[model samples]
Target: MIRTVLVALPLIVFAIAGLLAPLLSPYDPTSGDLAAGLQPPSVDHLLGTDQLGRDQLSRLLHGAQISLAVTAAVLALSLTVGVVAGAVAGYLGGRIDRVISRVIDMAISLPGMLVALAVIGVRGPGVVNLVIAMSLWAWSPYARIARAKVAGMRDSPHLDALRLLGAGPVRVIGKHLLPPALGPCLVYASTDVGAIVLGVATLSFLGLGVPPPFAEWGQMLIEGRPFLASTWWLAYPPGIAITAVVFASNLLGERLAGGDERPSILRWILPARRDRTVCAKDDVVLRVQDLSVGYPRRVVADVSYEVRRGEVLAVVGESGSGKSTSVLAPFGLLDPTAVVTGSIGHTKRVGVVFQDNLAVFNPLRTIGSHVDEAVRNAGRRPVRRVSEELLALVGLPAVARSYPHELSGGMRQRVQIAIALAGEPELLIADEPTSALDVTVQAQLLDLLARLRDELSMAMIVVSHDLAVVSRLADNVAVMYAGRIVESGPLLTVINSPAHPYTRGLLDAVPRPGAAPGTRFRTMPGRGGAGPDDSAGCAFAPRCPIAVPACGQGRPVLDVVTAGHRSACPEEGV
Candidate 1:
């Protein structure tokens, strides 16, 4: 509360001072009174009169109006130019990114004051020219900061989420990208405000600022310099005013640059609330049929799956088997260059918990706000109350006041989960939610997820490389090897009586608790398998221990081995 007051006071004071300068000055700043000349601290002339017999105080106040106006104008103009250029460069990488980056580098390499001077020299000194000159140099700071920030944002999960929501480049950049970028841009703009004021003053002092009768602070300093030794009142008052105003603006900008965690106290006093409800039991929550996701090569192929109400379907595979890709593709979140073909259907709301929690959030925004945004975007009810409740649900009640950087990896993951559950999604897609945490935290998160699944009666699709995770969470299992599902069935049946050679190999790969110390287990060979072209044949044939002659000719179909079990192997048919 104290911090907010300290930050806001200066801005309010400066704004009032800037707006009311003309009406408040005591005397005409340019009119001379020869009888009052060279007076110092007189009762009749507060702050005394200058060498030219002008009211020093009045001139100083009027000068502030010019300096503040220039600063405000420069900040607005520079930030606009910087944000547009930077966002374009960062969002569209490769050639465009390179070209924009090079241009920014060239601009930054030049001395700012010198560039401003050169521009002023050409345009002729005035309030308009000063603003233009300051803006030319000022934009580079925002460009650099925004470009760096946008580079990081390009790979963010929220961006992926927006893309999956069918938002085009313009909408995504305008809505999602611009709002988050505002924090850093504002911080940079504040600092630039101070720099611009100083630049304008420097130019005025050099006779390049507003013309003589305007009474700008920089011009006062320039005009007073000749009489400084005999009449200290001539130069000191305007100089002091310039210092105080710039200092106040800098301090305010610094505080704002830190970021605003909550809105105002008034906003909190009238806090808005929202209500969240669970989906119906009969809802056909989620479906992905024959979903094949490929990068340069096919990473996961011919995978068919579905999640009914209140069920969990876990997709388990090694790191390269495309478990992540399968989930991302169905969400329409993959890069445009990646080839994906599949059909997906779900009547319930869809939400995802990504592998890296921090990557999904804006580092500048509070966790509570992000949760609130999710609730709003999903059109959920009880927005404020549900956001807080969801935070508590994920064991992160205290995280409402914290930014992404302040939270631990596990805490961040929990926050991510809270955000996903904000809308009470009927289908939750958790992709390696526990991969970055320690065992204890991982277990806690897993338990929380299980409880939430039952409480909300939501279907969940869990993707992971850990078979143990699958064993604990999945009611049904889909086993992926290379780029295709080699076996899938009820968890117990698939684990205990696996049919495909690849499934057996995967089961053997799980380390046993009682195994001898340093004992190596059976391993698959040959460079962890082949590229997508290898899709012409059985994806796992090259690595399968029992591969036969026919395994090399063509890929096999998933033949039924039991009522709910299927395997893709000709040898299994034999």
Candidate 2:
């Protein structure tokens, strides 16, 4: 933003001077006083009189009107044509993108100066012809940039979600596609302005543009060329002015475009700012009250829970029970299709351990580099030191230089934990943290998590289908079924004496040693998936063993059972 202002300052001054050219200058730009020809700087003529005895400052100010106007017109024309073409091509791929891209390549290959000269030669030298010729090829760069940007972003999650919401192509492109594409295009147009202006002057210099004693910078230069040795004042002023404008514009545009070729040490030198935590005033790490995640249909609804510092809230449910969706909703990490509702509060930032280590970890980056990136993003300098410490903390002291593929499943999970810890986030969300690990490794990782929670004083929300894991690690438990939490409370109470039938069903399904050898384990009847989107009654009524006709009358909510315990239905208990 600073760069943009600085570059625009010179143009602002030129505009004011141009508008007041007659008032500011003591002499007419065209009607030169030949009697005082070949004069250098004096009290009367600020920049001296030209060979035509015209005030140099006056001609320069007047020339700015023509130059600035032509550049502005060119930018408007180029961007309009380029952006429209590129957007259509990018968003609607196949023949359209290929055909337009081919045309762009051909157009770019044409020699711009030669094409302009040829056009001027055919139509004769004039401003209209000059503008037409220059504008012919000016849009190519913007077209290519817009096309690439839109094509890359066309399949992004948000755009896909917008489509699923029944948004038309025009609305989607205008709202989602154009914004990202506009940035690079604007930067190109800004920096290209000075060049386009300079091109106009060059055309005039070659007798292909504004000709005569009409007070143009190029025409003035032409008149002063013979006196180069005799007087430097004649040509140097216009030359310096042109150079300054282009330099300032390029400097500003490059920065605004964020064209940094590589990372800078300055990022490390700058002190990091601490963002205010969003946790409750009473030391609650995270809280989600009446939260619901909406897809095209509502997936999870009216779920509420809180996690105090160092406490783990395990969200347990079977497949398609919205365990992942419910846990992720609090962090605002659900898919874009999910319209999350209700309140979520956290005192500090969050970090996560993803379900698939390979999908989340960059294939090209080593464990150390991955940890370094996380640390750097968190504003910690010298990532090497922090990464080393975090690796030791996660019990992988020797695996810093190892790649994701090089480590075992457990070691990779530790790397994920280390990366999460790098941010020093107050709340950590681990989605099915033990799913891919062997039983022994899962036990080790859960134990590691317990120790880390104690050491870091951070709260966690772990999503899983395993009851044994929850009983061991979770302080609080929320059992979900049919896109809703059936029961929630202290883990011990919920585990030992669950009050909701759905919660009881989940616990009963797990195989027990007391059962006879070779006896089959219990399983819930019905699909046990998310309920119909428009259903008015309890979604789990169909599968509930104790469900009566009244259970289908209305949606049930979490009602208080015992102290510090809640159940969605009052009918069942362990």
Candidate 3:
């Protein structure tokens, strides 16, 4: 609180002084009393007369108003330009990012003061010209800062989650990116106020500011220079005022810089509500048919899956098996370069818990706002009861006021779940939600998911490498290898009587606590790997111990093996 006050005091004082300048000035700044010209401090003229015989004290007070105004105007204009340019560049990336970044660098390379001076010299000194000149140079600092921050933040999991929630680019940027960026940008802009004021003063001293008779600090200094040897009052007061204002601004900037400046925690917590009521008739809440995701280097071909209402579908795969990509594609959150062809049916609403929880939140926004954004995007009506229930549901009732950084890893994941639950989504896609957590927390989260499924009757697709996590949460399992689903069946069938070689290997790898000591854990032979241009053959042939001679010719389709069980291998039939 004290820090906030200290940081705010200078700005408040500067504003007040500027506003009250007219009332506070003892004499008309433009009125020239020739008799008092060059006079030192006296009872009649408090700070004596300047070269033009104007009241120096009165002029100084009025001058402060112009300086502060110019500072504010330039700050506002520059920040607006910089933030918009940087945000667009950072979010879009590639060519757009490069173009904007280069432009910013070009602008920054120029000597800012020299450019301002040249612009003022050409445009002629006035408030409008001063603002334009200052902003031309001023925007670069903010742009650079905004670009760096946004570039690092654009690919955040929170943004990916937002994209999947049907939030358009504008909404995501406006609601999420802008708010977080505003705090640091505001600090930067405010601190630049002092510099802007000084720049205006410099221009005025160079006779590039407001015309004479319009009192300005720089003009006052110019007028008072001759009298400095005779009457210190003529120059001292205005000089002191400038010094005091600049000093206060600097102090405020420093305080704001050092203050508890993390993004608001409420942005992440408050808006999540589970309001979507489910009916039993909608058994297939989410259906992705013939889904294919194509990356620059590889393609996930003709993958089809269905998640039953309130049932979990676990997609298990090694790294780069396209499990995450498949889920992301159905959610309409794939990378721009990635082409997705598939129809997602009955996806009225979707919620996603990404692998990285920290990246799933806007650092600037509070937990409450993040949740609220999710709620709003989910098209759900605002209901306090629902929001509170969700917070409690995610086991993060007290973290409502905390930002993402303040929360622990487990806590952040819980918040992410709360965010996913905000819209009462019919389909929940969790991509390795427990990967970063300890076993205890992972177990707790999985249990929480089970409880949520029972209570909310939500359909979920959980992607995981840990078969145990999948077995615990999923009713159906799809084992993916090298961008293809090699086998899928009821969880019981796949786990107890696994058909695919990869599936068997995966299950066998799980450590048995009671196993004999010095026992080597079962390991899968061959690294399940494929190149982008690998022939349309079985992706897992190299790793399959049971691979037949025909396995290398063409990829086998998922053929039915048993009731609701399928495997894409000729060996399965053998």
Which candidate has the top score in lDDT? 2
| TM-score on alpha carbons, each prediction | 0.54, 0.52, 0.54
TM-score of 2: 0.52
Ranking by lDDT: 2, 3, 1
lDDT of 1 at 388: 75
lDDT tens per residue, model 2, 460-508: 8999988777777899998888778889899999988888887888888
Question: What's the lDDT for residue 491 in model 1?
Answer: 89
Query: What is the C-alpha local distance difference test score of candidate 1?
Result: 0.76
lDDT of each: 0.76, 0.78, 0.78
In order of TM-score, best first, we have: 3, 1, 2
| Candidate 3 deviant stretches above 4 angstroms | 1-282, 378-388, 531-536, 572-574
**lDDT per residue as tens, model 3, 1-574:** 6766775675677577778988988888889978768877778777777876887777777887878887888988999899888877878889989999999988987888999889988998788998999899999878877877788888889998999989997897677877777677887776787788878887888888767879888878777787578778766776777776677777666555544443222333222222333335357877888877776666686788898777899999888787888778876787898878878786677888999888878886688767755654554443333445567778878776778999988788878888887765778988998887888988888998888887767788999998987777899999888777889999999988877888888888998779998999888887766632346577777777788788788767888889999988758433
Per-residue error for 505 in candidate 3, Å, reads 0.4
68-100: candidate 1 lDDT, tens digit per residue: 888888888988888878887888789988998
